[model samples]
Target chain A: MALTFKPLADRVVIEPVAAETKTASGIYIPDSAKEKPQQGKVIAVGKGTKEHDMTVAEGDMVLYGKFSGTELKLDGKDYLIMRETEILGIL
Target chain B: MALTFKPLADRVVIEPVAAETKTASGIYIPDSAKEKPQQGKVIAVGKGTKEHDMTVAEGDMVLYGKFSGTELKLDGKDYLIMRETEILGIL
Candidate 1:
């Protein structure tokens, strides 16, 4: 399913990758113990403002966070990703 | 305990308010179904960059996120929050 909000100029929509549960000892780590990934998938993209060297687009997964970006929930599923500037790198 | 990294300047350290489990129906919401908070505390801050309007500082809980910021794990505990610019607002 697609998000209703389309990221605007230089922004991108992302769905962060799921976190892992197993610890190094093979113990199941609860969500309380895991850090969110600083990465995600680019769902929609705004034509980057022609201000800097922009290099991301729709469908491109990226690494971000200076850390930056907004979080959004839609259709009962949670997804994120924000301004391309918020994106630290393209993965 | 204070984070080892002291936010250099405008940044403030924050411990995000934990998320609530259970829907309105009181059904437990699994970690897999939850979104990480797009907010955090200022751990270490660089003195606010003088070029723009610097409106944040250490210990001042701010509402940030374009949404933006980084995630870092220290001593096995996870913490987040980034530049004042990344912070959308002060709480």
Candidate 2:
């Protein structure tokens, strides 16, 4: 499915990756202690603000703040919309 | 004393107005119950970003979020430095 929503300003639309339920050492993590996912794939990007240029491109894996972005649902899929500044780095 | 600090981007420096310790009905508010001040006077404004223009001027009374801005101390005075977007309105 295609995303029809367009973000404005420095905002970007992200498709969140599922939170990992297992630790790197093969330990299972319980739901009660699972942290919010902080990684996502860039789906859409806005024409950056005048002072800053867009640095991320579509399909890039990125790291962001755990609590960043507003939740959105489109075409039966979940997404997030937030400013590029909230994205900490491109992975 | 004149302020020598200049903020970059769309940031602004604000001198917070003291929080009222007394209620409008003349009741004294306890320290634990007093809210952080949300009103301040604009001391300096940065050149706005490309997508937006500066709307506030120096010495303008403004309102902002209670948790907005980074705390700053200059010339023995406390101040807040935040982006113009954090400013809710000019009073």
The deviation in Å at residue B26 for candidate 1 is: 23
- Show where candidate 1 strays beyond 4 Å: A21-37, B1-91
True contacts kept of each: 0.02, 0.05
Evaluate residue A27 in candidate 2 and report its C-alpha lDDT on the 0 to 100 scale. 21
lDDT of 2 by residue, B6-89 (tens): 565577889987555443445332335444437778998876667778999999878787788766544446677788998988
Over B1-91, each residue of candidate 1 has an lDDT whose tens digit, in order, gives 6567765554444554343332232222234433433333445556554543344445544334423555667767776756554553332
lDDT of 2 by residue, A2-91 (tens): 677889999999998654433232222223423322557899999988767787789876545567999998888889999987664444
**In candidate 1, residue A48 scores what lDDT?**
49
lDDT of 1 at A23: 31
The C-alpha stretches of model 2 lying farther than 4 A from their native spots are A1-91, B21-37
The docking quality of candidate 1, as DockQ, is 0.04
TM-score for the B chain of model 2: 0.80
